[model samples]
Target chain A: MPTFRVELFEGRTVEQKRQFVEAITKATCESLKVEPGSVDIILVDVKKEDWATGGRLWSDAG
Target chain B: MPTFRVELFEGRTVEQKRQFVEAITKATCESLKVEPGSVDIILVDVKKEDWATGGRLWSDAG
Candidate 1:
């Protein structure tokens, strides 16, 4: 079973999340040949202050 | 190129997360020989209702 953990910015609606999980489950089933129920996707929301790139926090960057 | 996605219960403090990332980064560097900056770890906090195992939701089981 291949579980997907997606990290992105917050402020998404429930409808968006429902569509996203459905699409991802379908794609995963098609490619991996696994059942939709077995595919687990966890979405993580990262704030600008919590994320960093190139040794600089995103909040600090312009 | 090794990114870690950890799914667990929420309610952890910033100090805990800071320590967690540091430890994970250190371990990854030692084992995979990847730099701290190269490793990214995304933590996913899963609600009991969202997680299911053995055809039963965690929230429903309890």
Candidate 2:
């Protein structure tokens, strides 16, 4: 199984996160032909000051 | 900074997830008193069949 870590700008809803998880899960499952239960999804949240994008902090950059 | 892997039942939206990331990031920064740029957040999504919760598949259980 392949593990993916997504980094992006903050400001989303629980529903939105759920969709992302579901979409990726389905995509991975089908592509890998592995059982859904065999997959694992983890969510890590980062703050603007703690995140960096384009050589700048997420908070400062975005 | 500590890396957290959150495993939960899927069915969230992108917006919802954004909020989660923000909240956790802020909390972690304050708790650790680390720069926001130092933190890294990743999101992983798993399908129902690939996820298991409470001894059952996430898709089948939920």
Please give the DockQ score of every candidate, comma-separated: 0.13, 0.07
Q: Which candidate is the best by TM-score?
A: 1
> For each of the candidates, what fraction of the native contacts does it recover?
0.05, 0.05
Error of 1 at A55 (Å): 10
Predicted candidate 2 versus true structure: per-residue lDDT over B1-62, tens digit per residue: 57776654467899989999899899989989988887778765544544332223345443
State the displacement of the C-alpha of residue B62, model 2, in Å, after optimal TM-score superposition.
Answer: 6.2
Please give the C-alpha DockQ score of model 1: 0.13
lDDT of 1 at A21: 93
TM-score of the second chain, each candidate in turn, equals 0.81, 0.72
TM-score of each: 0.54, 0.45
Residue range with the least summed lDDT across 10 consecutive positions in model 2 chain B: B49-58
